[model samples]
Target: MSARIQEPRSGGEPRRGETLIQQRNRKIILCAALDEFSAHGFHGASIANIARAAGLSKANLLYYFSRKEELYRALLTSLIDTWGVPLTSLDPDGDPREELLSYVRRKLQQTRTMPRESRLLANEILQGGPHLEGETLESLRRIVQSKTDLIRSWSAAGRIPHVDAPHLLISIWALTQNYADYDSQIRRLLGEEADISDTPQTFLETLYGSLLAS
Candidate 1:
């Protein structure tokens, strides 16, 4: 990991006088920390490694985040904020095919923009979601349930073909994220220039068309 310096916050919140340098440093630390944690998982990652990656000293990094777990939680919380964007975009009034296609596109975009974050999330799940306990788990469950409900509503309205809504969402997630989450195998199978994002739009058009067209 690289070393990054964060601007110190006074009085527990941003003041009118905060400089761009502080914000930039904070971002650098977070970005470096995300990369380190993604590559090493929670237990395997170290504060020194994260500080080195962020271009900051261990003491400086500690000033920004008190503990490793705090930094980990901050990263995960940031991920959850951005990760929910696609789901939040599902318009109840939009055409089902168009909506689903948009969702797929948004997910692919995330894969391209935040592959490290996606991998970090996948690592957490592989470890049985240990970090997402109590309120965090409940929040996630509620969000998933809400999206599942939307899918169910679409199916009931004859806007989409009947399928297990939860499973359908899961399939969409699996198919789209496979590119980022399994890049090595995909690269080996399809070659370097084979872009997953390029294929998803047309592939999803065909898939949903076949599945939903009456």
Candidate 2:
């Protein structure tokens, strides 16, 4: 039950200033929570189950997270940080063709490596994104708008063909993330052992290459 002890924090909140051990424990708890939530969803999951998966008691988990919602929010925050990496790497100063293609490659790589996180975000959006409101949503909007503006600038400079910046970004997301969000359907339709390797990468690069060529 992982010693089943409670640590005091301000207003029973998870500590903002965590020690090394606390950081390690928090990471363990979030990892376990991700698996549990991704499999069963928010309403279907329980703190007790996550605790068991993390080798901690329910109370021990609460000492770190306070509530299931908080834990879920933390998980989403971590996933957002990961998802932002590829988007944030888009360099307006770089060649438009290379930058956009690199973005496609990086996004596809995330789908392959972080399938669970991608599916988790998709599930949240399917549920109307109750947890993804307010500041988190605003932050996302700002980041996306910045990239879209960058894409528009590329078009204005005649670096790429005239394209709707927002929809182009949306299409890239839909195309790349389909592998993660619809893995089961894709696998069932293709084969049990179907491995989507460089096919999407090659096709997308070719498609966008033609679009981005000045």
Candidate 3:
């Protein structure tokens, strides 16, 4: 019989090794940095703040991420993965309304779970996407373009309305993200209410259910 070794999993305890320790520490730092960067925009955010939030010395945080920009980039990269997940499920093989509505539903849930991440991205873009320019922007553009093309193809095939695919997609993104980025305003407007994202989520279903009705 051959012995097997388990590689460390994300968010799990580290093994008895230096690399595992580094990985664990890196994860910790990134989580704290995500909160800090989300609360304060990039320039307003700092290495010292992230280190303090992570309960580590500035030197220790630097050991994992050498610079503020590097750490910010890392945070952006992770956020992209999280943000992209729901959109990536738009399958050409599925029924258009079902698939599209599923995407919107999941995105609504993400806003509830990842409101900080949503706000962070919004803040970055509002600041003209300094870190998000170049390769990052290009990669994001490519993904959006490909999905836009898919929607266009569906429209051409009469699978959905002849609505402008890009515009429709943009509407979905804007509508869903608003709940997260403008949460305080929405909550205040609600007046003495729990933070129930479902109100908007349900509204979206009814709205899109009508808008995309074939």
Q: Is candidate 1 or candidate 2 better by TM-score?
A: 2
RMSD of 1: 4.0
Worst ten-residue run, lDDT, model 2?
3-12
How good is model 3 by TM-score?
A: 0.87
1-214 in candidate 2: lDDT tens per residue? 2321122122223466878787667767877777877777788888998899888888888988888998888777767666877999999789888998999999999888877788888888888888886565677788999999999999898888889999998999999999988988998999987768778898999998888777
**Top candidate when judged by lDDT against the true structure:** 2
CA-lDDT, candidates in order: 0.75, 0.80, 0.77
Off by over 4 Å in 1: 1-21, 134-137
**TM-score for each prediction?**
0.85, 0.88, 0.87
lDDT of 2: 0.80
* Top-TM-score candidate index: 2
Candidate 3 residue lDDT tens string, 20-68? 6687677777777777788898989988988997779999988777788
Residues 1-214, model 1: lDDT tens digits:
3332122222123335668875565677787887888888888889999899878899987876789987887777666656777887888889887787788788878887778888888888888877776554566678889888988988898888887988888988888777778888888998988867677767876886777664
| Residue 195 displacement (Å), model 3 | 5.8
Ranking by lDDT: 2, 3, 1
Error of 3 at 151 (Å): 1.3
